[model samples]
Target: MRTGIRQTDVLIVGAGPTGLALGIDLARHGVDALVVERGGTLTPGSRGKGLQPRTMEVYEDLGVLDEILAAGGPYPVGMIWQDGRQAGEHRMFDPAEDGEEGSRFTGPWMVPQWRNQEILRARLEQLGGSLSFGREVTGIEQDADGVTAHFATGEPVRARYAVAADGGRSAVRRALNIGMTGETVDPDPLLVADVRIAGLERTWWHVFPPAGEGAGFLALCPLAGTEDFQLVAQFPDGTDLEPLLTLDGVRKVVADRTHLAAEAVTEVGWSSNFRPRAALADRFREGRVFLAGDAAHVHSPAGGQGLNTSVQDAYNLGWKLGAVLGGRAPESLLDTYEEERRPNAAAMLGLSTAIHRDEARRGAKTRQLGLNYRESSLSEETRPAPGEIRAGDRMPDLTVDGVRLFDRLRGPEWAVVELEDGVFLVRPDGYVGWAGDSTEGLEGYRARVGA
Candidate 1:
């Protein structure tokens, strides 16, 4: 019980993509935030390798898109193998036309999750934000003014608000006594690992279907910008999966399932096993503490929605937290964090589950471009009839007077754009907050949100 007082405007638990992204957002806004991670270092593994177009836009605003794009490449076509030979190509996502208008990004980019976390952590550090690793939060207590978080070691943290981005098994979330009700998307256990293997072409993702009855499927995806391939294997339901995390176990599984020899597996970087499931927290917020990312919603990785949704969760909450803490907006604005994000998270969870069961395809829905907060209390649609884009919808990227819409909405403040039809107020996260024929209610909206 070391007794020292460390104060920050916001305290974030977990240093994953969500916490790191939120730190970057808060740091740029001049908000004092401290990020604490239970682990000593960044979590390893290329578990979530798909970054949808919308997440790319968020990364661009956070000043890390260039690095992200440079570090990753477009997803390669899937190579279906038959009798240890290439059969045909399988497209994982819907194809996009060149030079699309609404988005600068065409489709999902492939970046290893560990590398993504490192990039975000670097950006947060560059912005003068602080992250404390090896500080597992044991308890959290919040009152009228602020919240205090207790850690396994070191002094407690006192902050105006606390965020749980600590993943599905969040200690903070459990401590808050919040319930998460969900269903198992698949009974089959999945083994995902990052490994270096020889004699495998990096040109395409290799798919190996189950050999016989009671067997499972295996897919080896070439992780961009690295020699590692993300290997995913599914076991029949009720099969014991505990032994698959070891290096020898993974090598054996690879040799047994694929055509490659066991010696081709040069190294195993990280490994884990899990049963796919979808769950959402009963509430995203409990008093001054809020849940973001996997702490709020758990999704199957089939559609690659988990990480993207988690990143967007931080994007949505970061500005609101900054605004409220800066005294620029009323505290009620914080309520919208849960209101707008929880429903969106729920939708993604269902999409992910559907994709897991092969009930849905990895198409436009997984890209997350169409997600909006139109029904949100924060959105004000004054138009009698909305056009292509409406209030609460994402502000599509377009050039106006030689300025990109995203460029105009890059900072921590809101911007009003005058299009052909009327005026639209774009939120800091690149969503249209209000739209009307004129700037009639714009002032009131601005004042209320402190935009």
Candidate 2:
């Protein structure tokens, strides 16, 4: 089944949302890329269904944030339940109180993972790039010249570099001998199902905590405003997944809180059993191969930060790779991938590893505002000063010239933000350099980034 080795500027593995995000960024930079997916089918139903403001900002910078928002449902309206009653809700992520100027993603947002993938896919297609489906990359060989990816079938692809945006259990990462060190769990398998119901308002996560010891818990998360929901429940030690198909079976679990009768159920879209894990690859890049998204880190789904972090990983790596390939930036710029993102990934890993039951976040800080990448190549020149958001501080939404990013930010380039005083400079990689009332300090800033 092997064909002659093929060549490309960049080769991406996995066709999930993370891979698509990377694809969109690479295409935006005018870097022709070939993205390959091992799976032949578009993952049915929305998985990992929440997008935070920072994520929205990334999408905005990508230029497709509006289309993405249009396809998404109402957001920041999630609630947690203890037993059968509501316990807490996500109501505020106020930017103004935090001293943020103007931003677009002012609150939390929701969008089915599939729709996000669809948007990125469409963008990739319009940008003259297509995904190679059903081609499983069995192996890879990289040298100074370029990288060659070997597939199980069809022709192999060769590129200047290969990016592994694969999922948590990335085969590419394993093959690279990358060490994923963290808490690996083998808890009793849990049931994860995506289904549609007729009588339910799909707005918040409905939790039915175990009333007694040894009893399993239940969590029903709404997706796309449809009665459809992704349900997760702990199993009694070792339980099989087939029984969930019966209407009575679903009622036995869902009826714990929702008054809806069993007759209201319609379809079961997808179901599986999994034990969540908190893992991080020892390194983000090696030789001509680099890892992005879940390929680099994975955490418990408790925080909904998994998808958000993966998208950010792609954002961090995309421009560095493009710059190196396009000959616009020096090779040393590539090292920042580990510097800026690894710390954040480590923090997320810590959050997931130390999760609190009945809550979606690890700590108050781990929420949307916890991400800060100060000590990066993008910030090495302009150190953090008082009265200004520092290099390692969260890149606050700057309101100047009417461009606002209150959500996930699309990036990989510098954002020339004009401040009232010194004209703050934003690195394309998403970091704030010098922020002053005047541009009187160009010599030091220019020397650091070699601009």
Worst lDDT 10-window in candidate 1: 92-101
Q: Which stretches of candidate 1 lie over 4 Å from their true place?
A: 1-3, 99-101
Per-candidate TM-scores read 0.98, 0.86
Q: How accurate is candidate 1 locally (lDDT)?
A: 0.92
Candidate 1 positional error at 69, Å: 1.0
1-451, model 1: which lDDT tens digit per residue?
Answer: 2247798899999999999999999998889999999989999999888999999989999999989999999999999998799999999887776546388888999999999999999999999999999999999988988899998999999998999999999999999999999999889999999999998899999999889998999999999999999999999998777787778888899999989998899898999999999999999999999999999999999999999999999999999988888889999999999899999999999989988888999988887888999999999999998788899999888889998767778888888899987799998898999999989989999888888
Off by over 4 Å in 2: 1-4, 75-102, 184-188, 242-252, 255-260, 357-367, 381-385, 401-413, 418-423, 433-451
Note the Cα lDDT for every prediction shown: 0.92, 0.70
